[model samples]
Target chain A: MNKLSRVLGVVRNQLATYVPRINATTQAAVAPTADPKVPAPAKDKHEGLMEFFDVKENWTTNEVRVGRSWRKEELRIKSNQDLHKLWYVLLKERNMLLTMQHEMNEKWEPFQSPERIDKVHESMVNLEEVVRERNRAYYLLETGETGERPGRVETNKVGMHYFFKASEHVVPPEHNNHWFKKFGCNRREVAKFRLYYNEKIWLGRLKEKNRNTRHVMKLYKRFPDLDEEALQAEYPDVNLERVKRWNGAQGHFMPRNL
Target chain B: MSTRWYPIYQRGNPQLRVFLPNFWMKLVRPEHKQPENIVRFITPTQMSDHDIKQYLEKIYKVEVASVKSKIKEGLIKRQRFRGYIIKEPDYREAMITLPPGQTFKFPDISTEKEKRDDDEIKKFQDAASQSFDKFKEMNKDRPGVPGWFSV
Candidate 1:
């Protein structure tokens, strides 16, 4: 509690220093604060809606300069509540950028500093990763399970495997008409497809090996003084001595010793 | 960090709350005229009307009267020279009705200052062109000579 209060006090002091200096004209346009002595109850919640758009000053500028995303180390020290609040802050920032980008697209003007969206997205991702780490740790300590959604790898009709995240349905899968209708295909078709896919992959590898062997022979034939160790390192799968013995290794020019 | 994963929802269990909802929403200009209190938005196709309502009310603290949404098909057109058809991704648009006595106007962002900035650039270019012409005129009489050869 003491630490929480200290943190809150620091935040309040920062806001107290920041808010009053807001441009007088913009302040008049915004809702009036209740008391000058204490912070004005965080302004009305409804006014938070406007935060989904860039500030007026930024709307006119061709470029908006911003700092880099929050690093994982910086977020790790913050309390969960602070992280939650910051998530909303970044959420608002993302929405604002999206809104501006859409508007600019409609007007056919380039959106300024498009990477700002990526920075906000990176910070949010890092913040979520940190929260998930904490959540996993707590769950494991208390219940011996990671508090994440259960999922399983399953093959689709197209013979591709994907992670199927399990979720509840009002009707169980056995009775669910749509689930049963869309579930699988004939087993023979899958087996055939898998065989053909494996065959193609094997052929591709064989062709690549032959190509590399030919290339190595050409390299030796063209440059008789070339280092053998580097050539072996490059094509470890192909035997350099075998390549050198190949008929292609005999060049039109006279041998290096002659 | 796995964004697509969500826990099963059961009748008796606590509601599955999204602590870090990664879905995004953008306020967009309405295609047609809307009421003073109505604002249009473009959101991910997977978002439902309830999700939009909850997102605005809980996250933004805006009082929403109702939300209606529809998915619009993106245009598919042929490239002029290449003759290949290019298709745009489909988008979902939500119409949010705010409670009475609220109004939102999409602010005009760039036009006012753009003209002034363009004029300033044009003036600078003109001055630069005049100075370059003067320099070239001075060098015209002595062909194939270095610039520092003369004063």
Candidate 2:
């Protein structure tokens, strides 16, 4: 509680220092904070409505500069509403970058520093996680349970069992035969797979064994005084002491004085 | 991570909606001649036929009569030094038939007729301005040399 208050205080101080210096012209455009009892100042209804893939701005510029993601600590101090606004901002940035990247590919022009798009994406994902954390906290405070996402387990299309996470659906499982058939899998194919899968595993093991043997041979071939203790620790499966006494671990070019 | 997984539904469910769907669909021109209502897409390999239906219906606001997807094997080549065969990942192409009346044609982005003329004009103007700037900067240092001489 004390830490939360301290963080909140720091954020309050930063808000006082920064918000006042913001351009006065821009201040009037943003809606002012009202009573908590009254619902959030009705946001522009068009705000979050599928603006990401809008086809308006196609050909504009070559290079784009973007800022770093908001850090966890920085986001933790923010109110839920501000965080939501920031999410939209990041979302818009991502959409713009993606559109530009798609256009660049279509134009066959080299996308300059494509990692900028990825960075924006990463930032958006992090911001989402931070918001989810705060939402969970708020729900816990209000309703006494973490409103974190839920998950479940189910079989795959191949009869292979896997976790099918719990999520809401447009149609209930009882009614949705399409979904039920979708979840079911081919069991005979899975059996045929298991046989080949074991063979592949055995082949991998054999290759791994050869690799280890060759590695040990190469190690001792180079070094006359290979540390046995260290070698044992490194290759616990191989009998290092026995391998050292064997002729395979010996150098061919020169006789060791030791 | 999957698009096909439809979960169990209950009353007053929060609309099992995805806030930010990571699915990407590229609107590509069809190769062969097709009906005006049909559109083609080179979508992600992981995208199912159902996903294509949902993407068009929900995002594009286009009614899809049917969606058929096929995986086209990528080009294969012999590696330069290793002498080993390398095959690229198979990309899925979805051919979706729109209900009716809707026609999508790839816009001609580059105006080919004016391109060469515009380039030639721009080049000549740039050359002229550069020469003018050089002429202006030339007469600053030399005593008797012409204005075009070394500055």
| Pairs with steric clashes in candidate 1 | none
Q: Candidate 2 residues A128-164, lDDT tens each?
A: 7776676677778998976655666765665445776
Model 1, A99-159: lDDT tens digits are 8888888888778889888888898888888998898888889999886877899888868
| Model 2 local distance difference test score | 0.60
The TM-scores of all predictions, comma-separated, are 0.75, 0.48
Across B1-151, the per-residue lDDT of candidate 1 in tens digits comes to: 3344665676799877787888899988899988777889988999999999999988766889999999988899999999999998888999998888666766676674366468878999999999989889998888788877887
TM-score of chain B of 1: 0.78
| iRMSD in angstroms, per model | 4.3, 9.3
TM-score of B-chain for each predicted structure, in order:
0.78, 0.64
Candidate 1's displacement at residue A17, Å, is 17
After superposition, the stretches of candidate 1 with alpha carbons farther than 4 Å from their true spots are A1-49, A150-181, A253-258, B1-4, B115-151
Tell me the whole-model lDDT of each prediction, alpha carbons only. Answer: 0.76, 0.60
Can you give the lDDT of residue A162 in candidate 2? 79
Location of the lowest summed lDDT over 10 successive residues in candidate 2 chain B:
B105-114
Worst 10 residues of 1 chain A by lDDT: A17-26
